[model samples]
Target: MYPERFSNLPEYAFPRLRALLDHHDPGGEVVDMTIGEPKHPFPDWVPTVIADHSEEFGRYPPNDGTPALRGAIRDWVARRFGTTLEADSQIAAVNGTREALYNVGMALFPERKAGQVPLVLIPNPFYQVYMLAALSVAAEPMFVPATRATGYLPDYASLPPEVLNRVTAAYVCSPSNPQGAVASAAYWEELFTLAERHDFRILSDECYSEIYRDTPPPGALEIAARMGADPERVVLFESLSKRSNVPGLRSGFVAAGPRSMARIRQLRAYTGAPIPLPLQRVSERLWAEEDHVIANRALYAEKFAMADDLLGAVPGYASPEGGFFLWLPVPDGESAALRLWQEAGVRVLPGAYLSQTVAGENPGKEYIRVAMVAPKDKTARGLTSLRDCLYR
Candidate 1:
């Protein structure tokens, strides 16, 4: 039977966007900036690598991941975050970060906590999967507002004692989706402290960890290592999607405390979908190399510069520090989205669609998330159109 908790879940972003704008013909040429699908060119050698290892695909892949892939991830974690993890002991491979993220709730959240219904704290305007994961685990999904006042990150510390007491897990996105806010090392420390105080697990989604403007954003694992925090209290999820422009590869990894990793591996042994062997080979190569990531970051940096130069003059423009989205404040997100489609022919996701109504107010109601994941010229054109039609 379907669960009642998810009965009222809002429709996903894209279908709702289609329902909102598909019927209306664009007044000008259409420029879609709604989804964060990467449009960059992946490494040329990727095809060759995959083809060379294609024969391995005939065999079933290991749920715990291969030594080479895990070791590569270990090295990547060390080089990027200055944190070390044992390849076989602390890490496990998954088909993608999305799957791992969902499964974590399944594997960790207990049926009851302190004789009370469990709670899952998630940031509003968050990745939709967080809410789904909570629902699947029968945990009360607590939507914490992540607004500009709070630096665009959720303030779980401000939660009431009762709410905090029941929290089983909390999902945090760095280089956050829609808003593109990067959580700092200080932020991670505070979160880790909160988890320690309340005795809950922290799921850090660092899928966009490699995409940044200035200095690289500090990661949760790095912060944990620095503080010598309880390793079991935190798990970091990462992917090669944005970092390597290999979303179709469907490969990612999770690094957790040894105990947590053991549980996750046990649960995955029965119900997990592992990455294919051939793609695992590709992932090993991707994680071992950073040249492509550097080039990808350069392209995004250029787009960010172009966006700043073009939209900086507009009122209420906040430049994103990391990730590839611009969360632009407009008069009304739904109206602005429709107006943009019908008048400017620019397609961007209405921020309202990404958030839930809390305390009779939707925090994302007045913003639109514009993805900077297009070619340079088209991105500029879309930004210019967005400016001329909506902000002008």
Candidate 2:
């Protein structure tokens, strides 16, 4: 009975990779580049802070978040975006943005919209949680193509009136995963305009906000505030995983208007695994500090520059403006991945694993997503092997 809900979902990305290539022995020393897990060092001070607050682990953490943690998030938001927010009413510290992303659909999605089955707009080649979240709420998920043709971001404004009218929410990933497309300020404004016209909400995922170059990616909340849009229009999710190199820390946050936050916190009261208090204490420190995040971004920047130096001359190679991934064009993602693994022992993810097949074609079928998350030397070796084996 339980299987029916998620029965339509495809096999997840990693397992699919295993099925495709695990049976074969490595052609050379394995150069794993498939998973997006960061290999950089986290703040050395993190453990000290956690140890100092270890006693708090005995107590149950706040359902949403501790006052200090939420306040730190608010301060970070203000400092980073120049937009002030109410920590008490508008923010909730989540285990990670992944959990918050999934639960937002549960907490905020309406049973019906415009007297019809509500639709959730998801970018194709998306973070997988967005689709699962939509399905959890029984909303029909519309996979909008975010391919090379669309500038690697979905053009939601182009959707027909029928589709727009039924949209309960839309998930947007700035510095989007796998593809590394960063949404611009004008893009956010256009999205806000569309939402205002259609009365749908925007779920903006900006976990990679800090992993950029000269210009920081414009956030939905910042743009919405500039336009003075409804406070309830955008739900923002962010994380310290990429920003602070603490994926295992499983710490992130969600911010929304009072009404939406209330719903989120209420649902969280029942289903949330509130972060352990010690971890919350550590998270408070992580969100407030900037030096470590800056250092972390510099490390990624170095790796990105390396990717450009190596792959810049290759056709269809675009140095990501933000985020640490290369969405390289290939004859077929699955086939290229297989060849790379067998011929050079370089592991990479097929872009098709991250996207849905809609209509007749999978938009990612012609591309492969390479994560530049390994150490400098290892990443250099992997990229060289990949270029030699595939591009050559």
lDDT of each: 0.92, 0.92
Q: In model 1, how large is the Cα lDDT of residue 339?
A: 93
Q: Where is model 1 more than 4 Å wrong at Cα?
A: none
RMSD of each: 1.0, 0.9
Error of 1 at 350 (Å): 0.6
State the lDDT of candidate 1 residue by residue for 70-121, as single tens digits: 9999999999989989998899988989999999988889999989999999
lDDT of 2 by residue, 1-392 (tens): 77576887899999999999999877778999988888899999999999999998889889788999999999999999888899999999999889999999999999999899899999998999999998988888999999878889999999998889999999999998878888999999999999999999999999999999768999998998999999999999999899889898899999999999999999999899888998999899999999998888898889888999999999989888888889999999999999999999999999999999998889889999898998999999999999999888
RMSD of 2: 0.9
Angstrom error of the Cα, residue 386, model 1: value is 0.6
Clashes of each: 0, 0
TM-scores for every candidate against the unseen true structure: 0.98, 0.98
